[model samples]
Target: MAGIELRKVVKNFGKTQVIEGISQSVPDGTFLVIVGPSGCGKSTVLRLIAGLEEVTSGEIFIGERDVARLEPKDRDVAMVFQNYALYPHMSVRENICYGLKVRGLPKAEQERRLALAADMLGLSEYLDRSPRQLSGGQRQRVAMGRAIVREAAVFLFDEPLSNLDASLRNQMRVELRRLHERLGTTSIYVTHDQVEAMTLAQRIMVMNQGHVEQYGTPDELYLSPATVFTARFIGSPNMNMLRASLERGRLKLPGGTFLPPIPATDAAFTGRAGEILLGVRPEDLLPAGENAPETLRCRVELVEVLGADTLVHCALPNEAEGQEPIIARLEGSSRPGPGDVIHLGIRHGKAHLFDPVTKKRLAV
Candidate 1:
């Protein structure tokens, strides 16, 4: 398997630019996920790498050779598309071996690779079945098997599991992860789903308006997002961003809640003051007892019970206008209903700081 690299790649359709000048070097056998909102150019980047779409400017490399001008077949990259691009007339076996047949590989070599791919994909018994007879997941596996038999230098997946049901999507995620573990192929997956990006990617490249917002491990993106967009986009239940600023020695929220300076947390903005932000995760806000330190008094607006835990949707005292209720994850047994007043304490050293002007996280 060979790594893929994009050097200042740019793609434009007339006056509308899709991919901006983006550069990244993915190491050999790395699982890199490109994720962003729809129309953010995530899929275009994947297509460019697959040689399905020509780059408007700059270069693309597979291993050591530049393949920007090469045809799709010569790039040695197999792409699994979103729509399950399978031949309806071909049986599973024929579909899997189509690439080998076109390349005029020997019958013996074709059978060997087909068998291995089928067995690995758990499709051995369904080889005689047509695409119409297979389930969505099975058809996806067949598409994957076709790519597998190619034994290409890189594997490109363009939202390959988007057609499956939620349960099947989860199931296929596990299967795909296992497939990567077994093959160790250099793979690039494009998807708008952050969960898929978080779970499958070794390094996630979060794209925004065709620019790279952040590129790092899941933990880095989650705990230390580069920008406010990354902070809001990467986490589940979404991080609560309160409009606040550095006061005499603390952070003051719109609700007039003042959080004392935790040296490490405040060092990044010691002298700076104007408008700043405090990013609080749901789990970081705890249901505190009376007289608890570093706690903000809030009135519960709603409660959502989710078996083991309950989500407390509440509004803090002196909250700013147009502020959405912040959610705090508490134990299922600790139910705080609407209108119930409670104190929510912030976990020490857990809050994130961001600049209001640049909308980027403050490095501490």
Candidate 2:
């Protein structure tokens, strides 16, 4: 396996800059995920690493070699694209062994690798089937098998599971994790789905508007987001943001009261006082009737039941116009339906405060 590095990477189309100076390293045998919204240069970054696109001004390194000027084949990397790019005329076994054949491996060696990959991926049962006769998930597995047999230094996946159904996607996710554990090849996966990134990635690089917004482990990005943008992006149902102001060592909002200065945040806000953004995750808020000393008076607006949990949408008396409504996730067993008047409590220690001007988290 090889470690990959990109230093000051930049990409452009005509006069428009699509990827601004980006620099990151993927450690040997690490699974790093590049995630962002559409048009955010995620795929472009993958292509840059694969040597499919020339860098505008930066260095691309695989292990100790500079491959910026090398061809894709010379980089010793395998890429699996979103659409299963299988040769329709070739059988599954033929498709898996195509790369070995091109590289002039002996016929016996090709057969051995093809058989091993097919068996590992459960494609051994359908080795004689053509690509056109396989299911979407099966075709995706074939594409992966092609990459696996290469035993390349690194693997690049470009949303390979995007075309599958929900159940199939989940199944493939588990399978991919197992495969990565077994091979331990350095991998860089690009996707727009936060769920996929959270489940599969050891570290996630969140991109936005040609730049990286944040890069961290899933828990770090979710629990202590460095910016307001990150707090909303990494969670389900998103995070609830409220306009707040510091008063008497406490945070005062329209419909509720918050904890005093966070033990870790006293230094950052020392002598500073003005508008601040309060961020709280959906799971951090609970039904108020439990009688927590600190509570918020809000009107229940709607309810959405999702298996084991229910999401509560509420309208706070202090809610700013045009701002999204607050959302709370509660146990499905205890959650009330729509229009249920209830008191809600905010988890004090779990609150996150951000500077309204810079959008940076208060150093708590």
Candidate 3:
């Protein structure tokens, strides 16, 4: 296993800068995921690390060695592409052992590695089958087995599960995690799926427009997002952002709703008393009891009944024209239909504050 580090890495195509000076470290044996939307340069970053693309500037280190200019073979890394790059003419055994043969390993050693990889991946029974005879998941396992036989120091996966169906993808995700635990190889997975990033990564680096937006553990990014972009991106159902004002330690929302006053000792509100952005997660907004203080009176516009839970989409009374309804995730038992008037309250200390101008979290 090897730790990987990038120091101000930059990549550009012609005059278009795709990677904007990204720098981060992946600890040895760590599962690090780079997640972002399309055109965010996530794949480019992975390719750069694989030595498929040269860096425009900066340095890359693997196991304390500078490999910025090294070829892919010399980088001591194994890559699993999205499409399983298996040879159609070869059986599973031949495909898995082909790399060893190219490197001129003894036949017995090649067999040993192939047996180990096949057993680890549960592909031992299909050794004689060609790629056409295997299911998508099994074929992917074959590709992974090919990489595993190399015993490379680092593993790079570029959206390796995107091609599978939903159920199969989930199954592969568990398999991948288990494989990592067994091999303890430093792995870098690139994907545009936030769900995959949250479940698989020890650390997640969120990128936007070719720049690093946030880098931290899943809990940190979910519970304490440092920027508005991250707050909106990392969560399912997306965080509901509202334009609001803060004055004299109190928060004022649209339609004249007022939240409880902020204590003077709270560092996040210290010296802040103007227009700000309020972020409330769907799960953090709940139905208020009768006569509850600090609640917003809204008219339900739609309701989605998900198993074990309900999503109430509501519009604030007297809200600005064309404003999107805020959704509250509630227990399935609480059924509120369209056109029903209800009051919702933010959970205690669950609200997130952001500077409207800078789009950054507000705190000391």
| lDDT (10s digit) by residue, model 1, range 1-364 | 7988899999998999988999999999999999889989999999999888999998999999999999999999998989889999999999999999999999999999999999999999999999999999999999999999999999999999889999999999999999999999999999999999999999999999999999999899998888988988887788888778778758877777677676785566667777887888888898778786667788899899998989999986555574546889888899977999999888888888888889887877
Off by over 4 Å in 2: 256-261, 290-293, 319-324
Tens digits of per-residue lDDT for model 3, 192-308: 999999999999999999999999999999998999999999988889898888876788886777898655326667566888888999999989985998897788999999989
Candidate 3, residue 155: Cα displacement in angstroms equals 0.7
Please, what is the whole-model Cα lDDT of each candidate in the order they appear?
0.89, 0.86, 0.91
**RMSD each, Å:** 1.3, 1.8, 1.5
Worst 10 residues of 2 by lDDT: 316-325
lDDT score at residue 273, model 1, on the 0-100 scale: 77
Q: Candidate 3: minimum summed lDDT over ten consecutive residues — where? A: 261-270
Clashing pairs in 2: 288-343, 288-344
How many steric clashes does model 1 contain? 0
Candidate 2 local lDDT, 191-276, one digit each (tens)? 99999999999888898888888888888888898888878888888999988887656777765566545656666677777688
- On the 0 to 100 scale, the lDDT of residue 249 in model 1 is 58
Q: Candidate 3: what lDDT?
A: 0.91
Q: Candidate 3: lDDT of 134?
A: 98
In model 1, residue pairs whose N, Cα or C atoms come closer than 3 Å (at least 3 residues apart or on different chains), thus clashing, are none
Q: Which TM-score value belongs to model 1?
A: 0.97
Per-residue error at 89 for model 2, in Å?
Answer: 1.9
